[model samples]
Target: MLTLLVIFIFVLALTYFVTRWAGSMQKNKMAGSNIQILETMRVTNSKYIQIIKIGSKCFAVAVCKDTMTFLCEVNEDELAYSSDSRVINTEGFKTILEKFKKDKPDN
Candidate 1:
């Protein structure tokens, strides 16, 4: 009976470890896929850095006319972020980006 209990405990521990490892692997794979998506983008005259995700959104910090803006990509929509940026949905984010893209260039 003691031998059976020890074997059962070993199997339980193995199952727990496997479950944790699978979860971690899924997270890593998701991160990598998102990274690939973030890599494909175009930034204009601004001195832009590449993307780095903080949480849900992919972000690029850039400077235009000595001001900082965070360019965020969220679900195919883009957001131009300043200090006062509000959390936005995909459509709102795209609208903000369209407006930003239409700005007249500073001389």
Candidate 2:
């Protein structure tokens, strides 16, 4: 029983290390890729709309389980982004919570 438990723990650790190594290798392989997913919105369980940047152009695409359809090309100037060029919520949770509390109706 003790031997079996030791084997299970060893297998788990080995599996974790292997998974991490593979992920790092894949990340390195894609480090120089020009294609990047700028954003994605889910419309259904299996359907999504994604904004992808390829080279210097951005495109909107509709993705389904097995198919991808090009929607349109997006103008970069029309999109809002932070100074770092990534779309992010600048508001802190505490700020949003305080605003919500102030807006709540009194009992």
Q: Among these predicted structures, which one has the highest TM-score?
A: 2
lDDT of 2 at 103: 100
TM-score of each: 0.33, 0.71
What would the per-residue lDDT of candidate 1 be over residues 13-87, giving only the tens digit for each residue? 999999999988997788655443234234576554555655566666565557767765554356455554443
How many clashes (backbone atoms < 3 Å, residues ≥3 apart in a chain or on different chains) does model 1 have?
0
Model 1 misses residue 3 by how many Å?
A: 0.5
- Model 1 segments beyond 4 Å from truth? 35-107
Cα lDDT tens digits for candidate 2, 7-31:
9999999999999999889979998
On lDDT, the leading prediction is 2
